[model samples]
Target: MTTSTTRQPIHTSPINLTFLGTASAQPSSTRNHSALTLRLGSDAWLFDCGEATQHQIQKSAVKMGRIEKIFITHTHGDHIFGLLPLMAACLNGAGGTVDGADDPRTQVNLNDSPMEIYGPLGTRAYIRNGLIYTHTLLGRPYVVHELRFPGDPQDGDFTHLPPHRSESPNGRNIPLKTDLNDTGTWRNIYSDNVLSVSAAPILHSVPCVGYVVNEASVPGKIDPTKYIPDIKRTKTPMSVMRRLQEGEDVELSDGTVLSGPPRRPGRKIVVLGDTYDPSPVASLAQGADLLVHEATNAHLPGIDPATKETDTYESVQERAISRGHSTPQMAGKFATLIDAKKLILNHFSARYPGDDDVNEEARKIMEGIRDMASFEYDGPVLCARDLMSEDVVLQQDNR
Candidate 1:
């Protein structure tokens, strides 16, 4: 009897999402403001850095240094007030020195890896002006990339005030796709070997944007037991085996063919800022593993026992839309339109405190919001709270 050799499959880290804050324009005693972190392995990406975001980071498991990129939906104070402070802290080495004390690497290479910040048209002006007016100097270099839509101000048009003495403004402004009318998706804002991020213009009071993070699909695992015998029989090189594992079909001199398995799809996460409508992102965000949408207002009866007044869903929804926000049902409708696997309602109003554990009324209100969203979408719904963490599961293929 011959023994079949088996090889170990490569392991990839799961993407974990942590909500640093889940408040709307006004923050309550429990919820801080709008901020969240998506952690993949050792690195993290921050979305919408609201007020007290750096302080919230201190309370969570996410490290400041690991946040390589920051994405802002708009320039609202509640969504961007924490950016300068966070950058300043990073420059101060609050997370730690770029290189370890005993490590041979030097900090001179810090400029090579500047932190990346992405946002709407005003992002560049906001950061640059903030840095200049506040006199907050970042020790390390940082870059800001603005996403401008059609009809926006052209470069050097003085619509966006230029920053003085800010060395990192590299004129890296990204514009909308010429075929946006047909595709409805913006240009891929950021991409690396592991992950790619894209954005779309959503309906808000200001120029707001929504982001979608897509992890690279990985090569499927191979059954070493089935291929090892053929490889040994045919005297095939180990390099051929590697090629087969990388989704390549290999043919040996003996006319034996080795076929690779199907690739495993990576997780997709859609996160939107304060927007009444986010349908523009549906094309890019379809079939997402997780959808994070704002639920700024909802009609929950008895939420305030003192008043004994119940606001109808239609009435509250009108108010939410007028303010360029979304209700729970509207968020659910968007999730359903995109066929999202899971939905998380965030950016709650201050009226509904997110202290589920400490306050029973708050917990009931949160549950009511989830229920309201569930009415439209059949997926699992979760009401976001401060410091809440969730792991996005990988989508597997049976083949």
Candidate 2:
């Protein structure tokens, strides 16, 4: 049976990932640009809104309106070409209903809450200029928050034109705190009740950042059997049970104190954009349940297949580093260094087609990349494909 990316009613998993696009600098026949979405409870957070991302979302199960927050690793065209179009669609009430299905979650009503966008320097100018030149007027408002690092572009210099008569204008772009912590991590780029996102500077040709999504720990399960007998014997109010589950010690009339166990730790998901060395974010991504790293190019040990040249691991690594990208082995090494439990390789080169099932050569190439990564990181590694969905199940907290 074919799986679906549609949100299920009963499954309230904290972090669910859907890979919208997995191509690198260029897109291929089967792959679009780089894009992905994480469904955190009711709201969806999008990362790297690449070209044709909206079309990819339409084909997937992710709804449009649920994408409340968008995080851009950089202002590369392949990473953010879809931003303006997506915002326009949100305002025009287009691209909401998939296959003519009427779902309110996919629609953005008039004067709906603004979409918050977080990105590296030059993001504000990109969004502001795109909207202005395109003559686009989103009925709904949106806000862009730029993250500036030292030596990066100066902030608060971009000016927005006065709103057109029919335009839904929003406030000026807000620049986040650029100060880095002791560990060099930008703490709490965004935080809410469900989860928090952090970022760190990464090595790239242009200024780039990687993000870490940490789900909030939840209360541990309460054993009703242990407390039911005490409740009946002491005639204690059942409200005390609620308090106990909330990690509070409650004393009954008979002086019986009930203490809940420690809270269960949530899952950690690390997602990085194109980078040669992503170690800057390693401190924040340690022991991640899922590490989504880029493997843009890999060595295929053969002569005269496509490039008519012999390939070696060292040669490929050197080329990838020069281009500000990562090979499968490099991605694996980083995952192993960070102690990631599972690794999903993404942002593949266009040379390797994404539709592995139909192309035997592509399938072998992808498998070869996975094997190369496994050589460094002794963990499960998956090559991401367009429209692929991953359900991240948090491990049981034995401690």
Candidate 3:
């Protein structure tokens, strides 16, 4: 139940991911469900808010007010049961007035801005019904955006669509579509000055998507030695130093020109929902710094007599595929195909006794991935647990 308020690293380049819940369909004694928070800069983005997610958040250090955007992978109860409750809590703290003014512990300012929720077609209706049934009056306005592919030929390419703004049924202004480019791979779903999010359709029981959050590349660190040969002797004006730090070329009075350093690539993290097929995920998460994928089962390809008393490995895999879920081995192979730097497997089946069993199962999957792939992958394979937080560092190419 450790909070992430002070756990994030001091470095701003790397984003921090906190696993609020890691169980799949069923809740376990240790794991709650599927929910994760990505802290970038001062804001936080949530992926897949599951049952009792608000409780999980309360036990952790993530601020409800900092969650500006929520991206639900699908309509499954395990992935979205906490959406309405969390929204309500954000507007009005657990013990506060509707406007959150009565609660002394409420951290979020009620007048800041409305939270934007993005999901599949039924997202808007789902939120509406939840509010109606619960008699929840939103103290502040909230917007629910449903993702849709345009039918027109010109707008067919999801990557080229412009940001579409429209009013929601609740009279909130919501952006229908986000800014995109002509990548023809994944569709850009949202973007701001700091981060850009993209999504790709993946095969699943319901309309599901995997999101990619790419932090915008930042200016590289300035090499003072390259610009200022003699630090103690060089008497540069304060304005010239400021210009150089801002990545601008500066000319001194003596006609010396110093060029700015190149930009450094930002970090990329991919969070996917339930899916049997991993091809779309691999494409969207190519070379991602971190890949957070669901490992709902530990099914192997062939039948294993050891597990035949209850279910064979082959039978378990069959069920997983039939139900549109991924086994740990499948998730590992997908991460290998995409060459992800690190693979954090979560959404574990409640059948696993504890983290030890989960890690052992993941190890077997990683071994399989190494054997199948041509290149050997020695990257870290983390078995995600509830409340486990990890820093997603940018892998700088020093070579």
lDDT of 1 at 194: 63
TM-score: model 1 vs. ground truth:
0.87
lDDT of 3 by residue, 351-382 (tens): 64334445666445434433322133456777
Each prediction's whole-model lDDT (CA): 0.80, 0.79, 0.68
Ranking by TM-score: 1, 2, 3
Model 1, stretches more than 4 Å misplaced?
Answer: 1-11, 93-111, 157-166, 180-182, 225-229, 235-242, 303-310
Clashing pairs in 3: 3-61
Which has the greatest TM-score? 1
Which scores higher on TM-score, 2 or 3? 2
Model 2 CA lDDT for position 57: 96
Q: Score candidate 1 by lDDT.
A: 0.80
Clashes of each: 0, 0, 1
Q: List the residue pairs that clash in candidate 2.
A: none
